[model samples]
Structure formats: C-alpha cells, structure tokens
Target: MFEWLRVFWQGRIFFLARGDQLPRFLNQALKDGVVLYHTQKSERGMRAQIKLADFRCLRRAARQTHTRVHIVAKYGWPFVAARWWRRKGLLTGFVIIAMALTVLSQLVLSISVSGNRNVISSDVLERAEKLGLKTWAYSKNLDLNQIAKALQEQLPDAAWIGIERNGTDIKIKISEKIRPSIPKEAGNLVASHAGLIKEIMVIQGNPQVHEGETVRAGQVLITQALNPSLPSKTTAPNSAVNNAVARGFVRGRVWYSAEKQILLVEDKVEESGRVATGWGIKFGSRVIMVTTQNSPFEQTNKEVTSPFLQPWRNWSFPVEVIRVNYKELHNVHLERSVVEARQLAEQAARTEVQSKITPMVQIVEENVKVLPSNSGAERVRVEVETYEDLAVYANP
Candidate 1:
C-alpha cells in the first residue's frame, strides 16, 4: 500500500528476470542502487516491481549479466500521461477532420436543374450562380425568393422557377410559359419574316430565293408563276391558273424584336450586413420583453421569428424565446447613365419577345439595337433570330 501510494504519481513497473544469471543480474541491480519491491523467485527466475526511473538501470544490469527482462505490468499517472502524449498528434488530426466535415456538410455540394424543356439547364445554372447559389456555397445564407426572382428576370419564358435544398444538394425546378399560336389560313405561300433562306422544297411553284441567301418579309417564297425566269409565264392575266397558290414550305432564319425604355436612375433602400438581436416572449398575443432597446442603428429592417411555438391545435409553451433580428438599412440612390440602362432594357425586351416566337423555332442569334434617347431613359430594342419554317400564306 505504501509503495503504491508513493509511486502513484511517479509510476512503477513490474518486470520478470529470466536466465541462469538471474542471481548475478539481481546483485548487479543492487550494485547500481536500484530498489525492487515484491521480489519473488520462480522456476524461470524472479518477478519484482521497480521504480520507473530505476527500471532502465535494472535493464542495463540484466544485459550485462546475460539475463532477459520482460515488462509484466504498468501502473500510475505518469504511464497514463506518457501514453496519451505519444498519441496527441493522432487525436488532434481526428478533431480537425471532424470539424472540417461538419462545416462542409452545411455547404451546397451538388446542384440539379430539372423540369425544363425549352430552356437549357446550363443557362439556368449560370443565372443561379449570379444569384449567389452554386456548388460549395453556404446553404443557410441562400434566399429562395431572391434566387427565384433572378431566374425569372433572366428567363422570361419560364413561368415559375422553384428552389429546394436538401442537405448539401440544391435542386431547381422550372415551368415554361405557354404562348398563343397564330391561326393559319391557306393562300399563296410568302415569307412571313425577313430571314436567311436555308432550304426550299417546292411540290409545284417557282422558287424565288436560293439556298444560303437572305430574303425580306412579304417576299414571294413559292410563287404561283411556275417559271419565275420568264417575263410572264401566266397565259391568262387574271385566272385561277395565273393566281395559283404556292405549294411548298420555306425554312429560314427569321428574326423577331421588342423595344423597351429603361429608367436612368434607380432608387431603393439597401440593407447593411450589421444586425442586432432582441429577446421577447409572446403568450397568445401578449408580449413580454427582456430588453426594451433592440438595436443601436438609426435605420433598421426588423423581423420577428418564433422558434418555440406549439403547432398542435394552438396548444402552448407559455414561455418561449422570441428572437427579433434587426438588420441595418441605408437609403441608396443608383444611376445607370452608362451602358447599364441599355443592357437592362435589352434584357427586358428579350423577355417580352419570348411570347412572339412561333412553334418549331430554334433560336440561333440574339442582338440589341440601342435607339437614341433624349429623355430620362434609354429605348433599347432586342432582336432574337430563330431557324424556322416560314410558310405563312398571303393572297396570290
């Protein structure tokens, strides 16, 4: 008991000495002034507890005496502390890896865009990136309202865009707007819009435009005049045969445009990042406040959220933590005197022109025409060209 109490902090080790030179090893340990407790003799040799500091001295003595020494047991705080010290680097690395995983789990890792038929998924992803939602972005900092609004502005053809977050994945859903179609009436086929003609498949008519050539709107695409090279192919001046309708479809790159005026100056209140919190309790519309002074900022955007409210048939937790977040706000005046207004107007015009596009139209080119402005805004016209079949008919 006394030896254990004395060596508790310092530590002690029990070792076995085995060899024909056991007596010489013990005598050598004594000569080195090493103390051994619980000494016993066995068939192999001897077993005893030596002070940890003296154990090394005993090992040197045994080596000199040609005896083998094996550790039997270890006890006390020094051994425990030494064992922990040796593995400190491994423990530290484990803690760091755990913390890193926890932080990364709260961020978006994968993004998926779905429910889009006409709009490209990559285009939607690009617009979402502009709205601060992307891979590796902090999921909690994202605002669904802002992302949806940005997508709407960027893709006017999309009727709605929904955003959903699940763990480290963000999924965006889109629904495109359906536009009204034009009523078709049969007559002489003519060019509906100015386009670069790509192909002409005529069953029975004169082809005015060739492949890889530009044509204007209202131009005769498949004229009733069978031989267009002739000065007058019609035998009758005003007969059904002379005014026979064109019979083929003309595929070309047709362009459609829309114009809108953009304001030069924009005014709004912007929110500053600084925020303050206030604690209060709401019991069935009765309020109890812990602090009357909520924020130090002069201008603030205020919001109240109740996290502890009971939703089971309005049954209540009488006391709950009501957090009021006050975000600092500042009045902002913005002017787009440069090309910003023109760019904005062009985006708006593109959105508006989405409704005018016909079926089988594949968009190929997009351009903007900035008209001269003397007023407080700029009038920008955006044109979208598409590859489509222009076979709309007119009176022969």
Candidate 2:
C-alpha cells in the first residue's frame, strides 16, 4: 500500500545509464537519500527505476560520477493522467463521460417482465411500478426480497417470482400457477354465447338440447347427472351412473354486428420536404445542443441518431455523437365522396369485427349496409355470422 501511494504521488520512471563509474553513481545516489529499485545490469548499460522527483537529484549524482542518464519509460497513474491532460479536448470528454456514467449507474433505465402467461405482463409491470421498481428509479433503494414478497402476496396466481438487475435494466421473472383441471363433480359445461345449436356432441354428460335449437347465454346445453335406471348392455347389474363433470363441444352459429362512421371531409398530414440537420453531444442525462438556429417549421418531425465509441475489445467510452434531423409537415383538408366514405367505413367495421372474434371462431356469412346519418357522416353497419364452439366450463 505504501509503495502504491508513493507511485501515485511522486510517479515512477525507468532510466538507463552507461558509464564505467555507474557503481559509484548508484552509491552516491543512495547516500544522497534517493531510492532505486528493479536495478538491472547488462553488457550495454544499466537500467533502474526511481521516483520521478528523486530522478532530478539522481541527475546531479550522474553528472558528478561522469555517467550519462537517459529516461526509458514512465509508469503509474500520475504519469498516465499527465499524458492525457496534455490533450485538453480528449481529457474533457473523458471526464464528462466518467462523471455521467457514475451518475447513470445508480438509475434504472428499463424494466422487463417475462415468464408470464395467464397473468398479464402489463399487470406485473404496473405492480412493480407501484412498488417503486420502475424505470428512472434509484437502483440502490430497491429491496429485491421485499418486492418479491409483495408481488407474491398481491398476485395469488404467481407460483414463483424473481427480480434481477443488470446495469440499468431490471427483469421480473414469474412462474404462474398451473390451474388444476376441473374435478369430475365440480364443473358443468354451459353455453358461452347466445346462438343456434348447430350440433351437440356430449362426451361425458347427457345432451339437454337438440340441434337447430336457439339457446340464450348461460343456458346449459348438457346435464352432468347421469340416468341410473337406464339399462345398457355395457353396464353390470345393480351398477349406478355417477354424476360427473360435463365435458363436450357444442358448436353453434353466432351472430355479431359492428358499426363504423367516416366523415365526408378529413384533414391529412403531408410532408413539406423542408428539413434541417444539427449535431449534439450527450453526456448521459445531460445533452449539449450545438445548433444555433431554431427549427423553421411550425410543425416538425424530429429524428435522432447516436454513435457509440468502442476503442478496444470489451471496452468502450461513454461519450456519443448525436445527430438530429427535423422535417416539416403541413395539414391539408381532403373531401371524400359518399362512395369512398362508405368503403372506408366498411373496412373499419371489418377490422372491428376481426378484433372481437377469436381464432377458434370461423366466419360463415357477412352482410354490409350503408345507412344515412343525421351527423353528415357516412355510417356503415356490418353483420357477421360464425360457426364456433359455445362450450365453456364453469364451476357448479
């Protein structure tokens, strides 16, 4: 520790000396209270390292002994810092970057949620944010164990939870509870939507309705109770049927409708082709703008591009160059014909229907009609009929 302190303060230098009286020069230098280390002697000359401040004193000793001294190398932090200080711009940039990184290391930049299926990712992130585990939060203030316990208590469906951090990114990993299958006695199959009963196939229950019958929502299409007195060749004498949970598919035709409206006049934004460019330097959270002129357009779209400084393998500088571009935009009013408005409204109605329907449902028929509106907007109504499974399991 003391040797390191000496190097840090006084620095260290390696020098070569060549003279017949080199031995005398070393003796005199030691006598004058100058320390020498890592001394080596070769056929050509001698090399040794001494404190940079002591080297000045050693020069006088070398002159008294008629020996020539030549500086070979310099080592230690002080010497390296001095070399960098000579280049003012490089030194300023490095200092700014170092300070920025030191500050950024304490703040969080991103939070990611993974390993969730039944529980929504947004729900997990919302909970984390409420607990002060979010982007821009102080990393050192977070307690992983406390946060994990809180999440477990809040989210009963989560079987396991883990919080981990790497640099500015935080990751929340969760293992959701696997819901157990419905017990044979606990659940019953029921209609998920009101529709016509196209077909009924009972796998573990008695059919309650016939094909082509219209059923309302929440009505059961199959009964869980089995008939005991019904005689069958497959059943033994005195054997009774058990009341088990119903399991089967009840496919039906379900009708859905969506309405969309489009205005006869609309405003559309178009690029004006006017662009301006500027450059800036970003030091972590602080950005210094180098451009002198303000943007010329009232409405503009801005884009930024930044480049990283990576000088060596596995090492990179924190400083970056930022380039910005601003593009002008103008809003123009457009008039739409009734036919064009109807087409756009129909397209929007179809999209709305697609969002409402699930992947399991197959659309079988569609009907579209354009209606007159008092608001001067073209209204398009779309009706879709689909053949889909209406069976949904529910606890008895």
Go through the candidates in order and give the C-alpha RMSD of each one to the true structure: 16.4, 18.2
Q: Which stretches of candidate 2 lie over 4 Å from their true place?
A: 1-186, 223-245, 268-285, 288-296, 301-328, 394-396
What is the Cα-based TM-score of model 2?
0.41
- Assess the local accuracy of residue 220 in candidate 2 as a C-alpha lDDT between 0 and 100: 68
Clashing pairs in 1: none
lDDT tens digits, residue span 1-396, model 2: 997876777788899989999889989999999999899998878999998778889877888999999899888888887888899998899899999998899999988989877678899889888998988888999997799868865664565688989999988888654343444424566666688998887777778888999997767677665555565556653233434556666789988889999989888898889899888887877778798245768998888887555357876557777777888999988788988999999999999987766533478999998887966589999999998777665433
Off by over 4 Å in 1: 1-267, 291-295, 307-320, 343-362, 385-396
For all candidates in order, the CA lDDT equals 0.77, 0.79
Most TM-score-accurate candidate: 2
Candidate 1, residues 1-396, lDDT tens digits: the string is: 986677797888988889888888888999999998899998877999988888778768877988999998998888988888899998789889999999999999999999887679999999789889989899889997788867865663565678888888888988664422323323346666678899888866677778998887666666564344433554655344445556766777877899999878878888979888888987777878787456778899888888776466757676667888889998888899757888889888988888788533578989888898877789999889888766555532
Could you tell me every candidate's TM-score relative to the true structure?
0.36, 0.41
Best-performing candidate as measured by lDDT:
2
